[model samples]
Target: MIVETTRPATTRRAARLRGALLWAAVAPGCAWAAVRLGGLDRGPLVQLLAFTPYAAAGSLLPLLLALALRRRGPAVVAALASAALVAVVAPRALPSGQPPAAGPTVRLLTANLLAGAGDAGALVDLVRRHRVDVLAVQEFTPAAEVELQRLGLDGLLPHRQLSPSIGTVGSGLYARFPISAGGVRHNRGGWGFDQAHGTVAVPGAPAIRVESAHPSAPYAVDQVGHWRTDLAAQPPATPGGPLGILAGDFNATLDHGPLRALLDTGYVDAADQVGAGLVGTWGPYDGDWIPPVTIDHVLVDRRIAVRSVAVHRVPGSDHRAVLAELRLPAG
Candidate 1:
């Protein structure tokens, strides 16, 4: 009798311990899902949201553990959390059906040169090999501008609107076609990063306004507000007015609220349209000891059709260049 009674009690204790362990394993994922689904990423969570891809991948481990343990309650919760995250993240790998848009093809490339330290020759080579019609450059410096012009970038892309500074605040836009209304503007409400803008006349298609975007990064708790402001300051795509494109290092991912809000204003991510959205464009390239994430983007108006998108490594820069082949809406 005593032995049997002790056996039952031990089994009960083991069951309780397993229940507690399962909850512990599942809770973090559930919390993360809540934050992401609710779009509650503010302050430090701004930085945290950049790694949502990793978190989405991690949510699976808890799910497997719950299934193996045969804990129905925890398993249900884990499944819900996993489902929510996967629903948001997994579709990025699948291409959306292409809309019917027939127009002249324009090849565009955008790069952040790490305060003008990136290899000018490699950048020029990418422009040449890709037959890039337009180039958006960020973190441009005076010395780097001289280096690029010396490397024959001017010959390849003669029309230019450049704002080269001594630090990472500068931006520029270069085009093979003539660019009118070309100018540079600073984000006055946020960090004063230069954004170069112009209307490119691409032969048979309608003129499209292109801007090199460089929003302030939310690297710290205090800077989150500035980051939000900078992203919000980006001009919205005019579906009714004219064709528009915003390209360069946005410093925020699609998971970010500010960026999503911007996209909701009628822009489509070129890579996302073609199932190349999961490719990482930042981190690891600069020896940061962190996993790569997609932050650099080419956001075109919803009317434009994205043909293909690619990312390339540039030596001496922390960011990889994004090349997008776009079909503009015919005039």
Candidate 2:
């Protein structure tokens, strides 16, 4: 007996509806991947690809929709597309099997204080919890500086280089070891584009050069050049020389051309080296719906190997703080 039971029109329509919805959701993801892969971002469009990595999350929507429709082909296609997105953003999400540097490890935390608006106690608590050896703060302001001191940061780290606030430029670097202040170095745009530099002498290891980098934000059209030029002007974190640690809010991302150039200079982003680069480090500022972005970075010379990385939320600041445990070459 040949029994033919055809599917109902309603079921067919529902399946088509689900498939349509799934494709619609995935369209933007495909577009973002195209822009990222094409490398078409330039000038005003440069920051466009910076947020493409976030689209990786959207890829799951298609898979879910395909499941509702019981469509195996769509499920496979959506999954492959999502995997492609992750592959494109790799090195950020990919693991590096390179062995850690020989000798003791140093934990470092770099954060932007949102013009000293972050919680002093929270920042101090973060330091204590992590037992961070070096702390680099951007947008460091007088109020924030005093609060840190009152919260026992000065007593904890002792050595310091706190600068005066000049727009969103003031920065501070505090360490348990002695710090040789290097004065505020102005970037291409000066004032707001300033970075605080210093040299820190660790117990037995060689001294490390630290910079609280806060280049001018490219949020405005006029600041685009300033941002690019600033990143370009910064020196490379070449190994063999004193281990250089460039950390803080770069206001830039790995997708950014200028930042990629900086990384090409024999320096490696600690977070990126350990699969934590995809984590968002900015957002939730004002009323704007800002998605978290990895604008914060801890760039270390090749001599220093990344051990582990982390990101944390601090009240008051729009950006999250990033920390990395780096193993340095034997002195």
Candidate of highest lDDT: 1
Candidate 1's displacement at residue 305, Å, is 0.6
- Predictions in order: lDDT: 0.92, 0.80
Tens-digit per-residue lDDT, 223-252, candidate 1: 888898999999999989899999999999
Each model's TM-score, in the order given?
A: 0.97, 0.81
lDDT of 2 at 329: 71
Q: List the residue pairs that clash in candidate 1.
A: none
Question: Per-residue error at 220 for model 1, in Å?
Answer: 0.3
> Candidate 1 deviates by what RMSD?
1.3
Candidate 2 TM-score to native: 0.81
